[model samples]
Target: MTGKQHLTGKVEALEGTKILCVGDVMLDRYVYGDVERISPEAPIPVLRVKDERSMLGGAGNVARNLAALGAHVAFASVVGADEVGEEIERMLGNVPHLQASLVVEPLRRSTVKTRFVAMGQQVLRADHETSAALTSAAQTEFIDRVRGLVPDVQVVVLSDYGKGVLTPEVCRAIIDVARAAGVPVVVDPKGRDYSLYRGASVVTPNRKELAEATGENASGDEAIVALARKLIGEAGIDAMIVTRSQEGMSVVMASGEVAHLPAEAREVFDVSGAGDTVISTLAASLAGGLSLVEAASLANTAAGIVVGKVGTAVVYLDELAAKLRENELSSIESKVATLQAAQDVAASWRARGLTVGFTNGCFDLLHPGHVALLAQSRALCDRLIVGLNSDASVSRLKGPTRPVQPDIARATVLASLASVDLVVIFEEDTPENLIRSLRPDVLIKGGDYTVETIVGADFVQSHGGKVAIIDLVPGFSTTKTVEKLSR
Candidate 1:
């Protein structure tokens, strides 16, 4: 697909999608150590500790991804009234646009997963958590909290790690409230009892969980598909997503259609929080206006970017964009994949009060006029995406010999500039559609065109955006250069 069509779905997925996450929250602790030699007492290797750190995990990881995606996230979970819980709240508070409805159950312990890493490999892991159900009072409080937020939120995400926080009663109550309010609910379910998530709009379970839940581990693909079909029918759910480690994800829709997304990560390190990332992104995108297929594709791309790093990790938009830029541009599928990977990062930057400026041109040759105009555009925004006309488009606008330089060469030159955050090629006659899809905060043109004449001026103005124009350096012009050289 072309750049225009590729980014259409992804861009639509960012319009005021507020998400509420309710489930298990855990602190991920990593103990980094060095193993030098074997101990004389036994055949075990001794590891000398160097450092330690902790991060949010499980449902908390889902919250992190939601925040990273620029969603208004309200987190509801159970934690002990201890120092660990205090630290977790502090961390949550530090994230922008995050709110919490935390319940302190004195008897329950905060869940924590501790991993020992030596020489880039995990040696062992220890989990500290409670698996017992919450008390009736606690469940009531959880339901009330969710009910209060249901009217404002667009979607609810339940991240179940088999921890005690997500009891059956609490899940049902919250789901009922969300349903009554006409909001969607997604669940990252665990264990053999999928019935707990019966009324959910969608539930994500891995291959193992699905097999165990339906008692069909050793069945064929048709059997698994049939079982998933049965579960979706019996539970009255809209969809079911089955996450297969290397094989990818299979999405079964209520329409009896199934779509499979092939995994795209080049490298895999720690798969700890990958599931949370996938489910969180999927729910947020769907709430934001993307179709189920589009949301699943975006989630798959986010997962691909995270597994390349170790431990529980989040994928930033800039890093993802850079990765996309490094890879070769091919079909529409590839372009969409790249954009999905960078969607959240771009949204986060926008949330931080950063203005995004966009401009497009043939820019066949680098001249002082081009430099001065680009520099001025960069001054108005935190980042710029320079759209370049394709070879065919450039040749059509100018003559066949007018370019004198290839499109790739021009793109390479533009990409090297410090002001250019991203470069996309358009084969069309005008960049009106591209600008409209991007919906940049500022639209910049080099010449003295009136704001009304700008292709995307109406869109920019409608969204409280502005239009800017920069004067060219008097002595320099690509046309002038070509004329002088010819003479």
Candidate 2:
């Protein structure tokens, strides 16, 4: 199979993939507001608080991402016996398909990072954390929990954030246990010493982390591979996957195999939990029986997707599937997506601060009027999604003889247009459900339909979106053209 096909198949097989994730868990909070003037007490800018949000951080993020990819994640971590730890436990419980084992350390403090932002820029960040290693009792209990869970999983991930969760002894214990069980261990390493993670299946380090760990120049592909090979040998690991921000990722093996994947070009937003996403995707792919190279490539694509979002976000399976299809298939073919995938694509666009536009029709026997409507709709937003009626729906709405083409054929024709970013085939007579799910920023239709007549106009307007009616092209009607041809 082609590489894309292989990766896509692996992604599809990710459902029910079992993985063990062990590392530090923290709470990430964001405080958003407006900065209108300087503070009266100091020269610093004042942030008028507007909104606040929180999510699981550190290894918890990895587990979250794994769950988002449909994996059955066994998450093992340590939390303090405090309110924040209790909150973390509550959040972990809410993550579907995840089994969390958290050891409560009475002497430790749960980590919490709060960032203050104004006008889309972060002004300050405050951290509340305890970096001390877990006490002996807590350590013993944690490792015992992880050991009990290792044999049941296909892969083990060690997410080390230097937050005292993955201590040297704990790392060695888990790695050895996993190795004994024939389950590969993937480590997101921290610190300069590679010896702590010896005998791991693979170690993933970013460009900076690789340089720091190896004490070598990892500036180019060749240098990175060299450093990775050296680290693999010294660290007693099978391979190393080095994540380069814009330069892409490099995978080097002790067996002298190497693959350098270029970065997927995407607008970079908050890169907070991108590493968590990469490791999560990697582990899930491995559990799904993908080769190391294929897993790295899939993880690379996933990293690209997560970085486009505004915060520490997990990449959904639909989003990854959509992006992979976009990468592997022809542009027109890629534009045809399932409703779930289209919804995810629309969400990704919105996360990148782009407005999404929606317009739908039978789109059979393509004509200038349809083209005009699509072009005008495209001009109204950053991305336009065309919801095409299925053959059954079209037959019901316009009679069996009305639609001259099948749904796929008509969708392909619409997708071939530059104005359409996505084409979703809806089985319903109208695109109301599709519109409601996608929740586009603007809803557009032909001038023949008024705002009151539009299917999703009220819903869109209720959500602070717009409704636009583009005038139809004169003398350009699909029914007239079909009649003329018949005559």
Candidate 3:
């Protein structure tokens, strides 16, 4: 069955999209440890800190969000002249292809939110900053910084934390200039006034924010639709996406078309920065030319990935792609089997219109070369079956001293690999009988052997199965491994 794995192609298409993220950025700090007992002075749990880490938060996170998805992201924002500001600058430099045009205002204090966590739960939090509105001079300079980058960016993201960096004037100036340049704008809005983000192409607000902004508490679809339309008309915004907690997301377009995506039913470990994940994914997806509905769907998946982690987590493109692929076959263990059981499994894979491939080896001692072969072979077909040589077969082929690990151990190890879907023991020197019975669509071997010389190649070809050979990782073999152990 076709599944989310189809989006892997779309992820690859996100490479090189230029995204400009502008908004209030913050320094997110984490202190993790264990809480053994209550504190002596207070009734709170005593946390003995063991580790400390920090990351880009708020708008800086939006830059990471785009970079994580393989987009070229540049951040434009304001920071105070402090140690937290220095740390943020250093970390931003470390991110791949991420640049920033930051205005360091002397009067402002850099925003820093430090959380004290114990056993993966937040025990306490500390905030240090000023949320006062930006001065007229600062707002003008901020707009100048963002306006200079608008023409070069494919998408402009205004990530507002209500931290005063995104003043109404700054927001209007940036949106107007960006729109004039034909660049679409996305906003993670804050404050009660929807007019601040009037010209933005999309405004993402949480359920609570949506209610507070519109002063409506009706939870039904009709009520939410009515409220969203009211805001869209009054604010002159193009669309609104309400990120409802547990109830899922409702996307309302100015054209009165609404699309809702159900909340992913999974054990959410933490909801920190999930909104950042949503906006970043939306920005990248939109820059990649997906429709509003398509972009939200992809953003929804990205949010699902982040909330499963324990902190203000960001989803990487490769990890998201892998998750989609893994979702295709939920029960992978069902694919592993012995010869008799493999027949039914192969039939099941075929019935689902999936292609099957076969490979065989003694696999007495697994190494990267073996792993590479299996991974590469699996790429050729949907299902991969590893024909393992039994203990007797190994002794006959390698010598009495061989079959070091035994058949069961070798089979278990091979089956544990993500690429090897099945492991079937074969007593014969070759997998001739097994191949003839399964008749896989393709037979794979290491590049060291030719198709004519590979065992079962002729039979596979006679049955309309093709032979494939993959390049081996250099300097990797059981012989070399055993030689090192002897020393």
Candidate 4:
């Protein structure tokens, strides 16, 4: 495949893959409020706390990110016998498509990072944890869990947070097992000594971590590559990625090839846990069979998104896909047309040996569920055509209060999505006329419907077209959103 097509294909290729993440796990707590006045007794500000949230941190964050990117992650970590540990374990258990093997160390305390924020900015941070190395027994138990996971996982991520969980012995044991299993190991290295991570496939470090590990001043790319190569040599790893915040990230391979990916332009709000985002994206991309450069580029985009978000956030598959499609917007713009224009495009696509899929909806209020449906629909075919119900048809089917957004606006939004190739608006109550005109190779619907019940199903079948049904995302509907607003 061409390089550009290969890179874009990675987004869809990341689904349903399994990744194993092993390292430090922590609970992140955020306290949001407005700091109005100064305290009378002390010199600190008197803040009115408004909201609080807790999320997976450290290695756990990496697992969450992998899950968000559509991978089934096996997370193995060591917690403690505290309530925070209990809470985090319960939370991790609820993460969809993630299996956890959390071993508890009675002598240690669970790691918890508390951040107090005001005006979308962190004011103070507190930590409750231990940095003591694991006992020999605990280390062995943890390594065994990871070794067990290696058989099922396509890639292994050593998400080190400098916590005692990833002590040298644990790192070495996991790497050896993974290497023996023929699984690629991606280490988010911690501490100054890179020797612990020796013989791994790749290591990811930020500018600060890279500089600290090698004591190399990163004034330029050549200097950074020179220093990163030094660490790669000493650690015996295959490659290194040094992430520079605004200047982007660099990939230095052991074979003396260096690649630089410019940072995705984003308005940074908070950079909390962006490093976790990087490693998770890198591992997922590599597991998706992307080249090292493609993986680094995808990781850079993911990190840029996380830094722009409000708090510790993940890069979802749809979000990343949308970002990747932004580069192809110019090509998509040419696909928007009327009935004749859409027919022409479909003929051309068929001539190129492409399978065309068709799905239609009012799409008055675009939500994650809609995006998910479109994404899955596109995955079933080479090209997808979306038939949008015009404003009058939407009002006729969905009532007068329907179509929260106008037809033109809705069409624009639908066209912008990556899963869509061409859009044709129909004035009829159903997309039957449009379907007959388009003659797509496949007809798709997001709802559970039988062939006899779906609109234009017989017509499609009579013309030898296949029908596909993708289930709807639960708890999401335009009517529900409007009702919630009214309430």
Candidate 5:
């Protein structure tokens, strides 16, 4: 079934699902700097540190994603009794309904992946960690704690980064406890052995891991499907999802049913912890009763969103809803603006007690469909905001030599329309982020969209908003107008 048909039931189930994530947790530290001078000893430029920040990594990132997706998430992981552990706690504290329990190992140094970025590019990365297996006593204590939480959760995720917390015994103990309690277990495995994850409900592996463990180079679509099936059988997992960067993912069910999901990413800025996003989303969806197919699809879309971010990040429920809305409007809405301005404009719409219906377009030339859609959009709400593409944004979406009119001219023409209440221009090719910022109460598109096709439909619908398809006016379009003019 399509995403929309399954969405209603799946989302309703999410509110009741509780998830527990336990595994290797790390702190991701970023040191931002500027390279103004070169070092005499080496060819590297000297970096003047400007800022330092830290976020949750590994299993902690999984827990963050689960919480952001509205699951009642409890994280159980080991942290060194140190400052990095304290900072990790502080970050996780900000998430609502998420609780973190730590087993501090005095002897173990907390895992920290610190990267130095200069002008948005990573200059170098430094790691502070230990990959040795936990002591037998520590492993038993961790298992007891996870067992205590297992009975209360509907699903469990074991995020093994090979950072020492997740040993074979720990994985087995988690799986046993979860199975005993009739709860689902999912794993993000590390190292070369697939046998460690035997009996998991699902195991997610990236292309490299899958290739390494299965001894099969699952590069093309057919090979991925084949490998997923083989691994599911060999590892005894109920299902397997192999994450293919840029290409999305392929899910293989225990019954050998293979489903392929395409990546929805328009741009990929950084893909530091996209796997965490996938596993987190899948666990929540499964706990909420989504089928393997439905859950995997949501995971695919969510991962696509996170990779566009700069570092390890979580996908907000509201952001997902906005992405769905934009997908719904792609055929109709055009033009784009900076995310900050888009948010400000969206806030303005919210305060007016008017449901600002938004739809964008290139509007290269004002045409009858544009006027009709704007009028119809205005009819749905007290006001209508037209998101236009700046000349640059348009060139990214449409080709160069396009936008027949500049952004300023297009804005002037759109502003002149009696139906258009406001106009905001965005710079990105897809208005995914812009739609997220504007978060219009009602998203208007042409009749061409289904609930699934609407980019921000999920975001809007999740927030009690509606998406409508307005009929296009006949004999309209910039392309047609251009054709006539050229003739």
Candidate 6:
């Protein structure tokens, strides 16, 4: 199988894979606004507050990413006895398939990093945190909690942000317990001390962190691998995975095995929480029974996805699966076809006694609404054929500025969706011709359209086929999106 296919299968196997994540947890808050002028009181831009949001940060983010990948995560972390800490606990409680063990340290203060963003750019960042190591009593209790949870997990992840949660003692204790339990430990290391991570199965350090930790040149692939091996030998770890931003990732093992996987991200919108995504996916993949190399490869893919999104986002299983399918040439080419090909494919499905469904749209900027419509359409039949309006047709029907993406681009994207079995581009404003040609078993459309208003409803129903009107997801419209972008 191709690498994408292999990784896709590994992602599928991640369901119910138990993971124990122990480390620092914080709340990341973003304050978004518009900056129209300079502040009179200080040398800074004045941000007119508009909106704000928050999400789990640090190791809590790692656990969130693991949960998003369909893993059963046991998250253990320390939080201060404060309102922010309470909010963090409440957020963790809402994540599915996750069991949180948050130790409350009354004397310590919870960490909160707030960034002020204006016009899509961060202007300033303020932090409220305490970096002092946990009290001895609290550390002992934390380690004991982690140790008790290790035996049941298939993998252990130590997410260290240098936030004082993963102290030297805690790190060593958890690593030893995990090693004794035969559960591999994945460490997202912080600071220059590799000794704290001794006995780990793998340590993931970005280029900068690797250089700082080993005090070596991590500029090229050879230099990186050398530094990684040096650290592995020095730290008594089995292997090291170095994340080289745009250059990709390098896997160096003490067994003399090495592989440099290329970066998978197409666009870099935000690198926030990317490391969390990598380590979480790596641990989850390993727990799913993949080899270290296979796990790292999947982690690389997950990192690629998370960076393309805004904020400290987690990569969901469906998003990862869609990305993998989009990367496969055979999958894309087979799904996107001409009208004649779609007709033939529909006929073949019908010949095999399969019900074929048909749906049509400009699908300009495919959003959740479009995805929901297609998925619901697919569920009504064994096969789904999507009639895509060509760019020219879209411009003629909607306007010259319609279809933000070109015809081929739209068709390829539509075909990439697992719900869509075939995508056929049509030059006309309506799919009446295509539907008449294919004579699908079911005709599907969004609920906004009635049977009388639907282009092919009469023809399909007259030909003994049924029409389905699936509810549209509220508050999503490509036209509104385009207008907003224009504004």
TM-score of every candidate = 0.67, 0.75, 0.71, 0.70, 0.68, 0.70
**Residue range 1-487, candidate 4, lDDT tens digits:** 5334456766877888889999899999988667889999999987687556788999998998999898999999999989999998998998899999999998889999999877656789999988889988998888888778898888999988877988888888888988898999999988899999998998988898888887768768988899999998888989999999999999999999999888885677668788899999999888998888988888888887677665666778766776676666665555566675566456546534577899999888899999999999999999999999999998999899878898878888899998999888899998898988777879999887987888878877876679998999998988899999989
What tens digits encode model 6's per-residue C-alpha lDDT throughout 23-69?
89999998866788988999888988755678899998999999988
In model 2, which runs have C-alpha deviations exceeding 4 angstroms?
1-3, 327-487
Which residue pairs show collisions in model 1?
1-332, 317-345
lDDT of each: 0.78, 0.89, 0.84, 0.85, 0.80, 0.88
Tell me the lDDT of model 6 at 398. 90
For residue 482, model 5's alpha carbon misses the true position, in angstroms, by: 44
lDDT of 3: 0.84
**Which model is ahead, 1 or 5, in terms of lDDT?**
5
User: What residue runs in model 4 are displaced by over 4 Å at the alpha carbon?
Assistant: 1-6, 328-487
Evaluation by TM-score, superior candidate among 3 and 5: 3
What is the Cα-based TM-score of model 1?
0.67
Please give the lDDT score for candidate 4. Answer: 0.85
- lDDT at residue 21 of model 5 (Cα atoms): 93
Determine which window of 10 residues in candidate 3 has minimal summed lDDT: 327-336
* Highest-scoring model, TM-score: 2
Count of clashing residue pairs in every prediction: 2, 0, 0, 0, 28, 0
lDDT of 5 by residue, 40-140 (tens): 99988899875566788999889888887888998998887898887777887887789888887878788899999877788899999889888877888
lDDT digits (tens) for residues 149-196 of candidate 3: 889889999999989998888888999998999999999989789999
Positional deviation of residue 453's Cα in model 3 after best superposition, in angstroms: 45
Q: Which ten residues in a row have the lowest lDDT in candidate 1?
A: 331-340
Query: Which is the better candidate, 5 or 6, if ranked by lDDT?
Result: 6
